[model samples]
Target: MRALALASLLFFSAPPPAAAVAPPRDAYPDVARAYWVELDGKPLWAGQPDKRLPMASLAKLMTALLIAENADLAAKVTISRGAQQETGSRLGLRSGDTARAGDLLTATLVRSANDACRALADWRGGDQPRFVAMMNARAAKLGLRNTHFADACGHDAPTQYSSVRDLALLARAAMKQRAIVDAARLPSFRFRSGAGREYRMNNTNALIGRYEGARGLKTGYTPGAGRCLIALADREGHEVLAVLLHAPERWWDSIGLLELAFDEAKRRSRR
Candidate 1:
Protein backbone atom coordinates (compact mmCIF):
# COMPACT_ATOMS: atom_id res chain seq x y z
CA MET A 1 0.00 0.00 0.00
CA ARG A 2 2.84 2.45 0.78
CA ALA A 3 4.51 1.65 -2.60
CA LEU A 4 1.24 2.29 -4.44
CA ALA A 5 0.85 5.66 -2.71
CA LEU A 6 4.45 6.62 -3.70
CA ALA A 7 3.70 5.89 -7.37
CA SER A 8 0.59 8.03 -7.30
CA LEU A 9 2.52 10.91 -5.72
CA LEU A 10 5.28 10.68 -8.32
CA PHE A 11 2.80 10.70 -11.18
CA PHE A 12 0.96 13.71 -9.83
CA SER A 13 4.13 15.63 -9.05
CA ALA A 14 5.45 15.57 -12.61
CA PRO A 15 4.99 18.78 -14.58
CA PRO A 16 2.43 18.83 -17.33
CA PRO A 17 3.40 19.36 -20.94
CA ALA A 18 3.77 22.96 -22.12
CA ALA A 19 0.67 24.67 -23.34
CA ALA A 20 0.62 25.25 -27.07
CA VAL A 21 1.04 28.83 -28.25
CA ALA A 22 -0.79 27.83 -31.39
CA PRO A 23 -2.69 24.95 -32.88
CA PRO A 24 -0.86 22.29 -34.88
CA ARG A 25 0.84 23.38 -38.09
CA ASP A 26 -1.71 21.40 -40.10
CA ALA A 27 -4.57 23.20 -38.37
CA TYR A 28 -3.84 26.37 -40.38
CA PRO A 29 -1.85 25.08 -43.30
CA ASP A 30 -0.80 27.86 -45.69
CA VAL A 31 -2.95 30.41 -43.90
CA ALA A 32 0.05 32.66 -43.64
CA ARG A 33 3.78 32.63 -43.16
CA ALA A 34 3.14 34.12 -39.72
CA TYR A 35 0.02 35.08 -37.80
CA TRP A 36 -1.04 36.28 -34.36
CA VAL A 37 -4.38 36.95 -32.73
CA GLU A 38 -5.45 38.73 -29.58
CA LEU A 39 -8.83 39.02 -27.93
CA ASP A 40 -9.28 42.09 -25.78
CA GLY A 41 -5.52 42.47 -25.40
CA LYS A 42 -4.88 38.86 -24.32
CA PRO A 43 -3.08 36.50 -26.63
CA LEU A 44 -5.46 34.00 -28.21
CA TRP A 45 -3.30 32.18 -30.77
CA ALA A 46 -0.02 32.59 -32.61
CA GLY A 47 1.92 30.84 -35.38
CA GLN A 48 5.52 31.79 -35.93
CA PRO A 49 4.69 35.09 -34.22
CA ASP A 50 8.33 36.13 -33.99
CA LYS A 51 9.59 35.06 -37.37
CA ARG A 52 11.02 38.09 -39.15
CA LEU A 53 9.01 38.72 -42.33
CA PRO A 54 8.45 41.60 -44.68
CA MET A 55 5.53 43.66 -43.34
CA ALA A 56 4.85 45.52 -46.59
CA SER A 57 2.79 48.71 -46.19
CA LEU A 58 1.85 47.89 -42.61
CA ALA A 59 4.90 49.91 -41.67
CA LYS A 60 2.80 53.01 -42.36
CA LEU A 61 1.19 52.49 -38.98
CA MET A 62 4.31 53.86 -37.39
CA THR A 63 4.30 56.80 -39.77
CA ALA A 64 0.72 57.65 -38.88
CA LEU A 65 1.48 57.40 -35.18
CA LEU A 66 4.44 59.76 -35.40
CA ILE A 67 2.46 62.31 -37.37
CA ALA A 68 -0.37 62.15 -34.87
CA GLU A 69 2.10 62.69 -32.04
CA ASN A 70 4.31 65.48 -33.35
CA ALA A 71 2.68 67.38 -36.20
CA ASP A 72 -0.22 69.75 -36.03
CA LEU A 73 -3.01 68.22 -38.02
CA ALA A 74 -4.31 71.60 -39.10
CA ALA A 75 -0.97 72.68 -40.52
CA LYS A 76 -0.51 72.73 -44.25
CA VAL A 77 2.10 70.60 -46.01
CA THR A 78 3.49 71.39 -49.43
CA ILE A 79 3.99 68.45 -51.75
CA SER A 80 7.68 68.09 -52.48
CA ARG A 81 9.25 66.88 -55.71
CA GLY A 82 10.45 63.78 -53.96
CA ALA A 83 7.02 62.95 -52.50
CA GLN A 84 5.39 63.15 -55.90
CA GLN A 85 8.08 60.95 -57.40
CA GLU A 86 7.42 58.10 -54.94
CA THR A 87 6.38 54.85 -56.59
CA GLY A 88 3.54 52.43 -55.79
CA SER A 89 0.05 53.29 -54.58
CA ARG A 90 -0.36 57.06 -54.66
CA LEU A 91 -2.90 59.88 -54.81
CA GLY A 92 -1.30 61.51 -57.88
CA LEU A 93 0.08 64.33 -55.80
CA ARG A 94 2.01 66.85 -57.86
CA SER A 95 4.87 69.06 -56.86
CA GLY A 96 3.76 72.34 -55.15
CA ASP A 97 0.35 70.83 -54.35
CA THR A 98 -0.62 71.40 -50.74
CA ALA A 99 -2.85 69.60 -48.25
CA ARG A 100 -3.45 69.58 -44.54
CA ALA A 101 -1.37 67.21 -42.50
CA GLY A 102 -4.45 65.51 -41.13
CA ASP A 103 -5.85 64.92 -44.63
CA LEU A 104 -2.57 63.35 -45.68
CA LEU A 105 -2.73 61.02 -42.71
CA THR A 106 -6.25 59.97 -43.62
CA ALA A 107 -5.06 59.08 -47.10
CA THR A 108 -2.12 57.20 -45.68
CA LEU A 109 -4.12 55.09 -43.24
CA VAL A 110 -7.26 54.59 -45.29
CA ARG A 111 -5.93 54.40 -48.82
CA SER A 112 -2.34 53.35 -48.12
CA ALA A 113 -1.24 56.22 -50.34
CA ASN A 114 2.53 56.17 -50.52
CA ASP A 115 2.75 59.74 -51.75
CA ALA A 116 0.66 61.05 -48.89
CA CYS A 117 2.74 59.04 -46.42
CA ARG A 118 5.95 60.37 -47.87
CA ALA A 119 4.70 63.94 -47.71
CA LEU A 120 3.79 63.55 -44.06
CA ALA A 121 7.15 61.97 -43.31
CA ASP A 122 8.98 64.79 -45.00
CA TRP A 123 6.89 67.41 -43.24
CA ARG A 124 7.61 65.92 -39.84
CA GLY A 125 11.14 64.47 -40.20
CA GLY A 126 12.55 66.92 -42.80
CA ASP A 127 13.49 63.81 -44.81
CA GLN A 128 12.43 60.20 -45.26
CA PRO A 129 15.59 58.67 -43.70
CA ARG A 130 15.21 60.82 -40.61
CA PHE A 131 11.60 59.73 -40.31
CA VAL A 132 12.61 56.09 -40.68
CA ALA A 133 15.18 56.55 -37.93
CA MET A 134 12.48 57.96 -35.70
CA MET A 135 10.36 54.95 -36.50
CA ASN A 136 13.14 52.48 -35.47
CA ALA A 137 13.72 54.50 -32.29
CA ARG A 138 10.07 54.34 -31.44
CA ALA A 139 10.03 50.60 -32.10
CA ALA A 140 12.85 50.16 -29.60
CA LYS A 141 10.99 52.24 -27.03
CA LEU A 142 7.89 50.11 -27.53
CA GLY A 143 9.89 46.97 -26.63
CA LEU A 144 9.39 45.53 -30.09
CA ARG A 145 12.57 43.54 -30.51
CA ASN A 146 11.66 42.06 -33.87
CA THR A 147 10.71 45.24 -35.79
CA HIS A 148 12.76 47.47 -38.04
CA PHE A 149 11.97 50.05 -40.74
CA ALA A 150 13.92 51.05 -43.85
CA ASP A 151 11.43 53.47 -45.34
CA ALA A 152 8.63 55.75 -44.24
CA CYS A 153 6.15 54.17 -46.67
CA GLY A 154 6.92 50.46 -45.98
CA HIS A 155 8.70 49.60 -49.22
CA ASP A 156 10.05 46.10 -49.55
CA ALA A 157 13.69 46.44 -48.58
CA PRO A 158 16.30 43.90 -47.51
CA THR A 159 16.66 45.43 -44.02
CA GLN A 160 12.98 46.09 -43.38
CA TYR A 161 11.07 43.43 -41.49
CA SER A 162 8.62 42.86 -38.61
CA SER A 163 6.78 40.05 -36.90
CA VAL A 164 3.07 39.62 -36.40
CA ARG A 165 3.51 39.87 -32.62
CA ASP A 166 5.34 43.18 -32.89
CA LEU A 167 2.74 44.52 -35.32
CA ALA A 168 -0.05 43.70 -32.87
CA LEU A 169 1.71 45.94 -30.36
CA LEU A 170 2.14 48.61 -32.99
CA ALA A 171 -1.52 48.45 -33.89
CA ARG A 172 -2.46 48.82 -30.25
CA ALA A 173 -0.33 51.92 -30.04
CA ALA A 174 -1.73 53.30 -33.30
CA MET A 175 -5.27 52.77 -32.10
CA LYS A 176 -4.56 54.95 -29.10
CA GLN A 177 -4.53 57.91 -31.43
CA ARG A 178 -8.16 58.80 -31.91
CA ALA A 179 -7.50 60.21 -35.36
CA ILE A 180 -5.74 57.10 -36.44
CA VAL A 181 -8.54 54.93 -35.14
CA ASP A 182 -11.16 57.09 -36.80
CA ALA A 183 -9.45 57.13 -40.16
CA ALA A 184 -8.73 53.42 -40.06
CA ARG A 185 -12.41 52.57 -39.66
CA LEU A 186 -13.76 54.63 -42.51
CA PRO A 187 -15.05 52.89 -45.61
CA SER A 188 -14.06 55.86 -47.73
CA PHE A 189 -12.78 59.37 -47.31
CA ARG A 190 -13.14 62.59 -49.32
CA PHE A 191 -10.96 65.62 -48.99
CA ARG A 192 -9.81 68.60 -51.03
CA SER A 193 -6.25 69.69 -51.43
CA GLY A 194 -5.21 73.25 -50.78
CA ALA A 195 -4.81 73.61 -54.53
CA GLY A 196 -8.55 72.78 -54.85
CA ARG A 197 -8.10 69.22 -56.07
CA GLU A 198 -10.99 67.10 -54.79
CA TYR A 199 -10.04 63.52 -54.08
CA ARG A 200 -11.99 60.49 -53.01
CA MET A 201 -10.13 57.49 -51.60
CA ASN A 202 -11.87 54.24 -50.84
CA ASN A 203 -10.66 52.19 -47.93
CA THR A 204 -8.28 49.47 -49.08
CA ASN A 205 -9.44 47.10 -46.33
CA ALA A 206 -12.33 45.13 -47.79
CA LEU A 207 -13.37 43.78 -44.39
CA ILE A 208 -14.56 47.20 -43.30
CA GLY A 209 -17.90 46.92 -45.02
CA ARG A 210 -18.38 43.19 -45.56
CA TYR A 211 -17.16 41.48 -42.39
CA GLU A 212 -19.47 41.50 -39.42
CA GLY A 213 -18.20 43.84 -36.74
CA ALA A 214 -15.10 44.48 -38.80
CA ARG A 215 -13.41 47.76 -38.05
CA GLY A 216 -10.84 49.55 -40.14
CA LEU A 217 -7.18 48.61 -39.97
CA LYS A 218 -4.61 48.16 -42.74
CA THR A 219 -3.70 45.92 -45.70
CA GLY A 220 -0.53 45.50 -47.71
CA TYR A 221 1.01 43.52 -50.54
CA THR A 222 4.20 43.35 -52.59
CA PRO A 223 5.87 40.77 -54.77
CA GLY A 224 8.18 39.88 -51.90
CA ALA A 225 5.83 40.40 -48.99
CA GLY A 226 2.89 38.63 -50.61
CA ARG A 227 -0.20 39.82 -48.71
CA CYS A 228 -0.23 41.19 -45.16
CA LEU A 229 -3.08 42.55 -43.04
CA ILE A 230 -3.81 43.91 -39.59
CA ALA A 231 -7.50 43.40 -38.91
CA LEU A 232 -9.54 44.69 -35.97
CA ALA A 233 -13.13 43.99 -34.97
CA ASP A 234 -15.50 44.74 -32.11
CA ARG A 235 -18.70 42.91 -31.26
CA GLU A 236 -20.72 43.23 -28.06
CA GLY A 237 -17.81 44.97 -26.36
CA HIS A 238 -15.30 42.23 -27.20
CA GLU A 239 -12.54 43.36 -29.55
CA VAL A 240 -10.31 41.05 -31.54
CA LEU A 241 -7.12 41.95 -33.38
CA ALA A 242 -5.44 39.70 -35.91
CA VAL A 243 -2.20 40.06 -37.83
CA LEU A 244 -1.38 38.02 -40.93
CA LEU A 245 1.92 38.21 -42.76
CA HIS A 246 2.35 36.79 -46.25
CA ALA A 247 -1.17 35.42 -46.54
CA PRO A 248 -2.40 34.66 -50.01
CA GLU A 249 -6.05 34.69 -49.02
CA ARG A 250 -5.84 37.36 -46.37
CA TRP A 251 -9.48 38.34 -46.48
CA TRP A 252 -10.80 34.83 -45.89
CA ASP A 253 -8.14 33.94 -43.35
CA SER A 254 -8.62 37.16 -41.40
CA ILE A 255 -12.36 36.61 -41.13
CA GLY A 256 -11.90 33.03 -39.96
CA LEU A 257 -9.20 33.94 -37.47
CA LEU A 258 -11.25 36.81 -36.10
CA GLU A 259 -14.21 34.50 -35.62
CA LEU A 260 -11.94 32.01 -33.90
CA ALA A 261 -10.69 34.69 -31.58
CA PHE A 262 -14.20 35.74 -30.67
CA ASP A 263 -15.16 32.14 -30.04
CA GLU A 264 -12.10 31.64 -27.87
CA ALA A 265 -12.99 34.72 -25.89
CA LYS A 266 -16.50 33.42 -25.40
CA ARG A 267 -15.18 30.08 -24.16
CA ARG A 268 -12.87 31.81 -21.70
CA SER A 269 -15.74 33.88 -20.38
CA ARG A 270 -17.81 30.77 -19.76
CA ARG A 271 -14.92 29.21 -17.89
Candidate 2:
Protein backbone atom coordinates (compact mmCIF):
# COMPACT_ATOMS: atom_id res chain seq x y z
CA MET A 1 0.00 0.00 0.00
CA ARG A 2 2.80 2.40 0.91
CA ALA A 3 4.75 1.70 -2.30
CA LEU A 4 1.64 2.11 -4.45
CA ALA A 5 0.88 5.47 -2.81
CA LEU A 6 4.49 6.65 -3.36
CA ALA A 7 4.35 5.72 -7.05
CA SER A 8 1.07 7.57 -7.46
CA LEU A 9 2.53 10.72 -5.92
CA LEU A 10 5.57 10.63 -8.18
CA PHE A 11 3.40 10.07 -11.23
CA PHE A 12 1.17 12.97 -10.32
CA SER A 13 4.16 15.22 -9.70
CA ALA A 14 5.90 14.36 -12.98
CA PRO A 15 6.60 17.17 -15.45
CA PRO A 16 4.35 17.69 -18.44
CA PRO A 17 4.85 15.42 -21.41
CA ALA A 18 7.94 16.21 -23.46
CA ALA A 19 5.79 16.49 -26.56
CA ALA A 20 3.69 19.42 -25.37
CA VAL A 21 5.89 22.20 -26.86
CA ALA A 22 4.39 24.93 -24.67
CA PRO A 23 4.63 27.57 -27.40
CA PRO A 24 4.70 30.93 -25.65
CA ARG A 25 1.19 30.82 -26.96
CA ASP A 26 0.23 33.77 -24.83
CA ALA A 27 3.05 36.03 -26.01
CA TYR A 28 1.57 35.83 -29.47
CA PRO A 29 -1.92 35.54 -28.04
CA ASP A 30 -4.00 36.62 -31.01
CA VAL A 31 -1.62 35.01 -33.52
CA ALA A 32 -3.20 31.63 -33.94
CA ARG A 33 -6.82 30.74 -33.38
CA ALA A 34 -6.05 27.08 -33.90
CA TYR A 35 -3.10 24.68 -34.21
CA TRP A 36 -2.79 20.97 -34.76
CA VAL A 37 -0.07 18.30 -34.95
CA GLU A 38 -0.43 14.85 -36.44
CA LEU A 39 1.99 11.95 -36.74
CA ASP A 40 1.66 8.79 -38.78
CA GLY A 41 -2.15 8.33 -38.64
CA LYS A 42 -2.99 9.77 -35.22
CA PRO A 43 -3.32 13.26 -33.78
CA LEU A 44 -0.56 14.24 -31.38
CA TRP A 45 -1.76 17.64 -30.13
CA ALA A 46 -4.36 20.25 -30.95
CA GLY A 47 -5.74 23.59 -29.86
CA GLN A 48 -9.03 24.73 -31.28
CA PRO A 49 -8.15 22.67 -34.33
CA ASP A 50 -11.66 22.74 -35.70
CA LYS A 51 -12.28 26.46 -35.43
CA ARG A 52 -12.76 28.15 -38.78
CA LEU A 53 -10.77 31.23 -39.70
CA PRO A 54 -9.45 33.01 -42.75
CA MET A 55 -6.58 31.01 -44.25
CA ALA A 56 -4.69 33.42 -46.52
CA SER A 57 -2.24 31.97 -49.06
CA LEU A 58 -2.76 28.56 -47.49
CA ALA A 59 -5.79 28.45 -49.78
CA LYS A 60 -3.41 28.23 -52.73
CA LEU A 61 -2.74 24.62 -51.85
CA MET A 62 -6.23 23.91 -53.13
CA THR A 63 -5.51 25.92 -56.21
CA ALA A 64 -2.33 23.93 -56.74
CA LEU A 65 -4.32 20.74 -56.22
CA LEU A 66 -6.81 21.65 -58.92
CA ILE A 67 -4.09 22.71 -61.31
CA ALA A 68 -2.15 19.52 -60.75
CA GLU A 69 -5.26 17.47 -61.39
CA ASN A 70 -6.58 19.18 -64.52
CA ALA A 71 -3.54 20.48 -66.40
CA ASP A 72 0.00 19.65 -67.28
CA LEU A 73 2.78 21.98 -66.19
CA ALA A 74 4.05 22.15 -69.75
CA ALA A 75 0.69 23.42 -70.97
CA LYS A 76 0.77 27.11 -71.78
CA VAL A 77 -1.66 29.58 -70.21
CA THR A 78 -2.05 33.09 -71.59
CA ILE A 79 -2.30 35.74 -68.91
CA SER A 80 -5.53 37.69 -69.20
CA ARG A 81 -6.04 41.32 -68.27
CA GLY A 82 -7.89 40.17 -65.20
CA ALA A 83 -5.11 37.84 -64.22
CA GLN A 84 -2.56 40.56 -64.83
CA GLN A 85 -4.33 42.96 -62.46
CA GLU A 86 -4.78 40.74 -59.40
CA THR A 87 -4.05 42.41 -56.07
CA GLY A 88 -1.33 41.41 -53.57
CA SER A 89 1.91 39.57 -54.41
CA ARG A 90 2.55 39.16 -58.13
CA LEU A 91 4.90 37.45 -60.51
CA GLY A 92 4.82 40.60 -62.70
CA LEU A 93 3.14 38.79 -65.55
CA ARG A 94 2.13 41.05 -68.36
CA SER A 95 -1.41 41.07 -69.79
CA GLY A 96 -0.33 38.63 -72.45
CA ASP A 97 2.50 36.69 -70.82
CA THR A 98 2.16 33.21 -72.25
CA ALA A 99 3.76 31.10 -69.53
CA ARG A 100 3.90 27.35 -69.23
CA ALA A 101 1.44 26.07 -66.65
CA GLY A 102 4.37 24.60 -64.72
CA ASP A 103 6.13 27.96 -64.50
CA LEU A 104 3.01 29.68 -63.24
CA LEU A 105 2.54 26.93 -60.70
CA THR A 106 6.08 27.42 -59.46
CA ALA A 107 5.37 31.10 -58.94
CA THR A 108 2.07 30.46 -57.24
CA LEU A 109 3.25 27.81 -54.83
CA VAL A 110 6.76 29.02 -54.10
CA ARG A 111 6.17 32.75 -53.93
CA SER A 112 2.45 32.88 -53.23
CA ALA A 113 2.05 34.96 -56.38
CA ASN A 114 -1.57 36.11 -56.71
CA ASP A 115 -1.26 36.97 -60.37
CA ALA A 116 0.13 33.56 -61.23
CA CYS A 117 -2.68 31.84 -59.35
CA ARG A 118 -5.26 33.88 -61.23
CA ALA A 119 -3.74 32.91 -64.54
CA LEU A 120 -3.75 29.25 -63.57
CA ALA A 121 -7.37 29.53 -62.45
CA ASP A 122 -8.42 31.15 -65.69
CA TRP A 123 -6.66 28.47 -67.65
CA ARG A 124 -8.13 25.70 -65.53
CA GLY A 125 -11.73 26.91 -65.19
CA GLY A 126 -12.22 29.53 -67.94
CA ASP A 127 -12.64 32.20 -65.25
CA GLN A 128 -11.73 32.95 -61.62
CA PRO A 129 -15.29 32.53 -60.28
CA ARG A 130 -15.66 29.18 -61.99
CA PHE A 131 -12.37 28.05 -60.51
CA VAL A 132 -13.47 29.09 -57.03
CA ALA A 133 -16.62 27.01 -57.49
CA MET A 134 -14.39 24.10 -58.34
CA MET A 135 -12.41 24.70 -55.19
CA ASN A 136 -15.55 24.54 -53.07
CA ALA A 137 -16.68 21.39 -54.84
CA ARG A 138 -13.38 19.68 -54.17
CA ALA A 139 -13.48 20.76 -50.53
CA ALA A 140 -16.88 19.14 -50.15
CA LYS A 141 -15.65 15.98 -51.82
CA LEU A 142 -12.84 15.82 -49.28
CA GLY A 143 -15.35 16.08 -46.40
CA LEU A 144 -14.07 19.46 -45.32
CA ARG A 145 -17.09 21.29 -43.97
CA ASN A 146 -15.24 24.33 -42.70
CA THR A 147 -13.25 25.15 -45.84
CA HIS A 148 -14.32 27.38 -48.70
CA PHE A 149 -12.46 29.32 -51.37
CA ALA A 150 -13.61 32.66 -52.77
CA ASP A 151 -10.42 33.06 -54.77
CA ALA A 152 -7.61 30.80 -55.91
CA CYS A 153 -4.87 32.97 -54.38
CA GLY A 154 -6.34 33.08 -50.85
CA HIS A 155 -7.17 36.79 -50.89
CA ASP A 156 -9.18 38.11 -48.00
CA ALA A 157 -12.90 37.61 -48.39
CA PRO A 158 -15.84 37.57 -46.04
CA THR A 159 -16.82 34.04 -47.03
CA GLN A 160 -13.40 32.38 -47.38
CA TYR A 161 -12.35 30.29 -44.38
CA SER A 162 -10.94 26.96 -43.14
CA SER A 163 -10.01 25.12 -39.96
CA VAL A 164 -6.67 23.60 -39.05
CA ARG A 165 -8.18 20.15 -39.41
CA ASP A 166 -9.31 20.84 -42.94
CA LEU A 167 -6.01 22.54 -43.80
CA ALA A 168 -4.03 19.54 -42.54
CA LEU A 169 -6.04 17.29 -44.82
CA LEU A 170 -5.35 19.70 -47.63
CA ALA A 171 -1.63 19.80 -46.85
CA ARG A 172 -1.18 16.04 -46.89
CA ALA A 173 -3.20 15.88 -50.07
CA ALA A 174 -1.18 18.63 -51.71
CA MET A 175 2.12 17.07 -50.72
CA LYS A 176 1.08 13.88 -52.43
CA GLN A 177 1.01 15.79 -55.70
CA ARG A 178 4.48 15.84 -57.18
CA ALA A 179 4.37 19.42 -58.41
CA ILE A 180 3.27 20.95 -55.14
CA VAL A 181 5.73 18.89 -53.15
CA ASP A 182 8.52 20.03 -55.44
CA ALA A 183 7.64 23.71 -55.45
CA ALA A 184 6.62 24.09 -51.81
CA ARG A 185 9.86 22.60 -50.57
CA LEU A 186 12.17 24.77 -52.65
CA PRO A 187 13.86 27.87 -51.23
CA SER A 188 13.71 29.82 -54.50
CA PHE A 189 12.87 29.39 -58.17
CA ARG A 190 13.59 31.55 -61.17
CA PHE A 191 10.90 31.99 -63.81
CA ARG A 192 12.04 32.90 -67.32
CA SER A 193 9.61 34.35 -69.80
CA GLY A 194 9.27 33.81 -73.54
CA ALA A 195 10.66 37.33 -73.93
CA GLY A 196 13.75 36.34 -71.91
CA ARG A 197 12.64 38.31 -68.85
CA GLU A 198 13.48 36.61 -65.59
CA TYR A 199 11.78 36.78 -62.21
CA ARG A 200 13.16 35.12 -59.08
CA MET A 201 10.71 33.98 -56.48
CA ASN A 202 11.57 33.57 -52.81
CA ASN A 203 9.60 31.16 -50.70
CA THR A 204 7.09 32.82 -48.41
CA ASN A 205 7.33 30.20 -45.67
CA ALA A 206 10.22 31.06 -43.34
CA LEU A 207 10.44 27.59 -41.85
CA ILE A 208 11.46 25.87 -45.08
CA GLY A 209 15.16 26.73 -44.99
CA ARG A 210 15.39 27.40 -41.26
CA TYR A 211 13.91 24.27 -39.71
CA GLU A 212 15.59 20.92 -39.81
CA GLY A 213 13.51 18.28 -41.57
CA ALA A 214 10.97 20.91 -42.68
CA ARG A 215 9.53 20.11 -46.09
CA GLY A 216 6.62 22.47 -46.64
CA LEU A 217 2.95 23.03 -47.45
CA LYS A 218 2.19 26.78 -47.39
CA THR A 219 2.09 30.09 -45.47
CA GLY A 220 -0.58 32.77 -45.17
CA TYR A 221 -1.23 36.11 -43.50
CA THR A 222 -3.87 38.83 -43.59
CA PRO A 223 -5.07 41.28 -40.99
CA GLY A 224 -8.25 39.29 -40.69
CA ALA A 225 -6.59 35.88 -40.71
CA GLY A 226 -3.41 36.53 -38.73
CA ARG A 227 -0.63 34.10 -39.67
CA CYS A 228 -1.32 30.65 -41.05
CA LEU A 229 1.17 27.90 -41.77
CA ILE A 230 0.98 24.25 -42.79
CA ALA A 231 4.45 22.75 -42.32
CA LEU A 232 5.44 19.14 -43.11
CA ALA A 233 8.51 17.09 -42.25
CA ASP A 234 9.63 13.48 -42.73
CA ARG A 235 12.23 11.57 -40.73
CA GLU A 236 13.04 7.93 -41.35
CA GLY A 237 9.54 6.49 -41.93
CA HIS A 238 7.66 8.99 -39.79
CA GLU A 239 5.77 12.01 -41.11
CA VAL A 240 4.66 15.04 -39.11
CA LEU A 241 2.08 17.57 -40.23
CA ALA A 242 1.52 20.79 -38.32
CA VAL A 243 -0.88 23.68 -38.83
CA LEU A 244 -0.99 27.03 -37.04
CA LEU A 245 -3.74 29.52 -37.82
CA HIS A 246 -3.83 33.21 -36.96
CA ALA A 247 -0.47 33.05 -35.24
CA PRO A 248 1.95 35.96 -35.17
CA GLU A 249 4.98 33.98 -34.09
CA ARG A 250 4.06 31.21 -36.46
CA TRP A 251 7.61 30.17 -37.36
CA TRP A 252 8.69 29.58 -33.77
CA ASP A 253 5.40 28.00 -32.81
CA SER A 254 5.61 25.68 -35.77
CA ILE A 255 9.22 24.66 -35.05
CA GLY A 256 8.44 24.05 -31.40
CA LEU A 257 5.34 22.00 -32.14
CA LEU A 258 7.09 19.97 -34.85
CA GLU A 259 10.18 19.14 -32.76
CA LEU A 260 7.95 18.16 -29.87
CA ALA A 261 5.81 15.98 -32.10
CA PHE A 262 8.88 14.33 -33.62
CA ASP A 263 10.16 13.47 -30.15
CA GLU A 264 6.77 12.01 -29.26
CA ALA A 265 6.79 9.92 -32.42
CA LYS A 266 10.23 8.60 -31.52
CA ARG A 267 9.06 7.62 -28.04
CA ARG A 268 5.97 5.95 -29.49
CA SER A 269 8.13 3.87 -31.79
CA ARG A 270 10.06 2.57 -28.80
CA ARG A 271 6.80 1.54 -27.15
Highest-lDDT candidate: 1
The model with the greatest TM-score is 1
> For candidate 1, lDDT tens digit of each residue in 116-229?
999999889999989899999999999899999999888999999999999999999998999999999999998999889998999999999889898868999888899999
lDDT of prediction 2: 0.80
**Clashing residue pairs found in predicted model 2:** 31-246, 31-247, 31-248, 32-246, 32-247
lDDT of each: 0.86, 0.80
Q: Candidate 2 residues 1-271, lDDT tens each? A: 2334433432333324434554312222232578777877466666776788899999999999999877888987888888889988887888876888998998898899999999999989999899999999999988898898898888889999999889988877787789889888999999777666788988998878887777887888777888788888887788888888887667766766666667767776787
